[model samples]
Target: MLEEELVELRFRLGDGSDMGPIRYSSALTIAMLKERIVSEWPKDTKITPKGSTDLKLISSGKILENSQTIAQCRTPFSDLPGGLGSGGAGGGVITMHVVVQPSLTKTKTEKKVDDMPKKVTVCSCTIS
Candidate 1:
């Protein structure tokens, strides 16, 4: 396939740093893109995603669904959100923002009832 036919993509972190000008087929799914992002994630970043489930990809103010294709998520250059532009030499690169979502397991810890101290109240009855 010709280079122009492929979609050029870049990933931007919450810190405003960018990842790549990697070329991909428009047919690629958002889930697949997340996998790529996880693999190419920078080691120096303070926040890291443990898996695709921990990452959220946003483009043009829309959070891309896992089932959505690259083509579906792309927007016209003029309509690009967040001041993003068509970058790269060819000028069609789409910059997607990557957000690391805290996992439910990490954010919500279950406490065992047995671990808590029981409170006991003594009832006193007085009869005249």
Candidate 2:
């Protein structure tokens, strides 16, 4: 089955250099996703977002990195004017959407066997 997802992002830089908003993607599992999120955060701080979207309409909430929660968000984009405009100034808002597509192909060890016999006999049990 095909798997797709949408994620909310919070581009926060305490330094206030105005890096602007960013949309990121990944295929890591929820466990890995949580790990990555915390690991990527400054000093591994887990963000407890209070609002789903920021003052700039950017998202700042909990999101599933392995599901379809992202479809609810619009795609074309409504980029904020501030911090990204000419001369890019101070502190920007949080409002960005990221799409993550994960591949689900089976590994070699899990591949289907086409040459296996319809029935097989083991020492004490019969296999089919």
Candidate 3:
């Protein structure tokens, strides 16, 4: 594929910071993109994704599915301001929002609570 045909993408975190202005093939799948994101994730961030499953890629106000390709997720140039009649490497770079949602698993402290002994109450009744 020609270099001009490649899609340029930038990943934006919740903090409004950017990851890359990297070029990828239009045929690249969202799942593949997630893998790349997990590997290239910034180490400085307090919250990091454990795996690709923890990532959600949102583009153009829509959540991109794992099966979707770069071309399918790309926003039309007309929809962007100052993006008319542009294509290829020099064209506007699409920005995708990356959300890291960790799995809801019980922590060690929670497990310890379950292991604790239950309180016992003894009631005594006296009848005359």
Best by TM-score: 3
> 43, model 1: CA deviation in Å?
0.8
Q: Give the per-residue lDDT of model 3 (tens digit) for 21-42.
A: 8888888999999999999999
Shift of residue 109 alpha carbon in model 1, Å: 4.2
> In angstroms, how far off is 27's CA in candidate 3?
0.5
Better of 2 and 3 by TM-score: 3
Best-to-worst ranking by lDDT: 3, 1, 2
Pairs clashing in candidate 3? none
lDDT for each candidate structure: 0.80, 0.35, 0.81
Tell me the lDDT of model 2 at 116: 56
For candidate 3, the per-residue lDDT at 122 reads: 97
Q: What is the per-residue lDDT of model 1 for residues 6-99, given as tens digits with 9 covering 90 to 100?
A: 6788889988899997888777899998999999999998999989999999887888999998867764554655433343345466778999
Candidate 2 overall Cα lDDT vs. reference?
Answer: 0.35
When 1 and 3 are scored with lDDT, the better candidate is 3
Worst 10 residues of 2 by lDDT: 49-58
